[model samples]
Target: MKLFLIGYRGTGKTMIAKILATAWNCEWADSDGEIERRSGKSIAQIFSQDGEASFRKLEIEVVRDLATGPHKVVSLGGGAVMGTENRTTIAAQGLTCWLQATPATIAQRLEQDSATKSQRPDLTPLGGLEEIQTVLDQRFSVYQSCADFEFDTEGKSPNQVADEILVTVAKEQKMNS
Candidate 1:
């Protein structure tokens, strides 16, 4: 089955997904990267030029495509779960892990990652931690609704998170079997 990483922008979904893919010997697909590849434009460009609505439409299409594909480690864009269809697809298609962190952690992480800042468009005009909290408040319920498991990414390295996911999955499988 597909293993999906769902979380806010700075929650290390991409990093953890890569680690999981490598450790599991499977392909890894990132929703944002795939959107960029398909559109021939960066996500920020898409948002600035075409608008968030258009970008979200594209996100739904990408999620649908990936949801129907074979097993792999998939990292979804931060806002992909905003769409009901996308959330449904994820819930039906994969084992989802919600990588969570505090608003302060998210703000700090984003501040540290210049490349990520360049690629993403601001969702709101609020500053720093306030913006993070605003976005989290809007999406936290959706993330929880679709996730089969939750992984805390705060103060954890990508390798550490990956190891935890592996152990958790093993335990789940052991229980289910």
Candidate 2:
């Protein structure tokens, strides 16, 4: 079955997805990277030139395409779960795992990932930690609603998170069976 990772930008979804993909020996897709490759532009470029609505349109298309496929692991854009259609698609297509982290941790992680700053656009008038806080506050409930389960990335390595994900998925399967 497909496994989808849903979470905020700095929540280690991408890193953990890579680990899970290797361990499971399955293909993995990153929604933002797919959009950038398909559109021949970075995500920030998409947001700056075409606007967030347009970028989100592209995101929806990518998400839908990936969701319907046999991909082993999929990491979605931070805002991907905000749309009802996207949430519905994920819920039906795979096990949705939320990789969560506090705003403070997110801010620190973002600060370290300089390349990501250029690729991801800002969503708030308030920049820095304030921006992360504001966006997380608005999106927390939406993330919670879409996720079948959560894994906090705070104080955890990507490998550790990947291990936890495997355990959780196995547990979920056992419960369902």
- Off by more than 4 A, model 2: none
User: Per-prediction TM-score, please?
Assistant: 0.96, 0.97
Clashing pairs in 1: none
lDDT for each residue of candidate 1 in 31-140, tens digit (9 for 90 to 100): 99999999999999999999999999999999899777677999999999889999888888878999999999999999999886778888999968999999999998
Lowest-lDDT window of 10 residues in candidate 2? 114-123
Candidate 1, which segments miss by more than 4 Å at Cα?
none
lDDT of 1: 0.91
Best by the TM-score measure: 2
> Candidate 2 on 63-160: residue-level lDDT in tens?
99998866589999899999888988899999999999988999999899977678878888898899988999899999988888899999999999
Model 2's alpha-carbon lDDT is 0.91
Clashes of each: 0, 0
| Candidate 1, position 22, lDDT | 92
